[model samples]
Target: MSRIAESFKNGKAFIGFVTGGDPSLEKSEEFILEMVRGGADLVEIGIPFSDPIAEGVVIQEANIRALSAGATVDKIFDLVASLRKRTEVPLVFLTYLNPVFNYGFSRFFQRCADLGVDGIIIPDLPYEEKGELAEIAAGFGVDVISLIAPTSEQRIKQIAQEATGFIYVVSSMGVTGMRSEIQTDLKAILEVVKGVSSIPTAVGFGINTPKQAGEIAKITDGVIVGSAIVKIIEKHGENAGPYIYDYVQSMKNAVKELD
Candidate 1:
């Protein structure tokens, strides 16, 4: 089974996100191992880009730092290639569509397949325009994951049904960041998702605390934490790995409470 699918099988999946080449590629690699060791069921590596519209200030700065530090598409691929030798955790690229277009879609997916990447989450690519990537991804064994917003009331059924690996259920409306409280009707949103398909759903955006993760875990298949992690990297730099390891473990423990 695909590592992503396998994660859902195990229980509440704790998906961790980190920008590739944040402080440095070597540090990013260390962070990935720490995340896995801390019990992250899946990891989303942010491919640094010049403009990340879906991200809030935390991740936008992370992108800038990574890009400034010379994190290129080839370099990120090489990083993952080396990582594949040591671990088989589900690795998904959380990137914008422009990078893929510039790199040549076919070649990008080809390299991903060769390097054992399990799936991809392009926040900019809406469902209507996913056909192009989906067609190529199918041939290369990569899942072009889909996202369902809280406001996607009308299109939730359609989006949920066609989601490949898992559905990324956006917890709030704005760009990705940590929040004090998520006031959206997530239970109602998840209802539409569950009614439509069996594909697992993971909620992201504004999930910083263990209590928050546990509450979301009650309804979704997994919990995705991003900006909170980036803050750790920003504060600790190369030494953030150990702190991230403990943070991820705490989050994972929170999700385990769902059982």
Candidate 2:
């Protein structure tokens, strides 16, 4: 099985995301290791972009902080290279298309292959336009993960059928952030995806607390927490490692309970 597929094979996956170089690249690596130590099955590292259209206030601020701290594409690649030496956990890039375009798709995916990145999530890349990078990414064995929002009514089937890695089921309609409640009829969406494809589905966007994680895990194969983790880092800055480990451990335990 692909590394991404293997992540969901044992049980419900707890996928964690953090903005790369948020506090600093070193801290980014530290936080990721902590997440793995805390039982995260997969990790999504955001390559800071100037205009992250899919991000909310928390992550947008994180992007700015990372950029200001000099988080370049090269630097992020180096970060992944260093991470590969320490862990084999699946590492996926959550980035916009512009940077990949600027970096050259072939060169970018080649680096990903070389550095042990298993998959990528491009929020801005539409399903139809995925061909722009999908073909190249596939050549290098990188899965271009697909996202399905509640608004993806008829297209959900189409997207799921073609999806390579696990499908990212967006819990709400808006951008990424924490929310008190996610009333998007997610089970209905998962039903559609399951009908067409056996690929694992993970719900993300606005998922924070263990209660929410457990509730969502009951319905989906996994739960993805981003803004919540980023919030922890934002509050703790360079010292967010142990806090991240604790939070992720709690979240993972919540998901594992469903198993």
The runs of at least 3 residues in candidate 1 whose Cα sits more than 4 Å from the true structure, single-residue gaps closed, are none
Per-prediction TM-score? 0.99, 0.99
Which 10-residue window of candidate 2 scores lowest in summed lDDT? 123-132
Clash-forming residue pairs, model 1: none
lDDT digits (tens) for residues 127-206 of candidate 2: 88889699999999999999999999989999999998899999998899999999999999999999999999999999
Q: Give the alpha carbon lDDT tens digit for every residue of 1-259 in model 1.
A: 7888998998899999999999999999999999999999999999999989999999999999999999999999999998999899999999999999999999999999999899999999978898988999889999998899987889999998888999999999999999999999999999988998999999999999999999999989999999999999999998898999999999999999887
> What TM-score does model 2 achieve against the real structure?
0.99
Residue 248 of model 1: what lDDT? 99
On lDDT, the candidate that comes out on top is 2
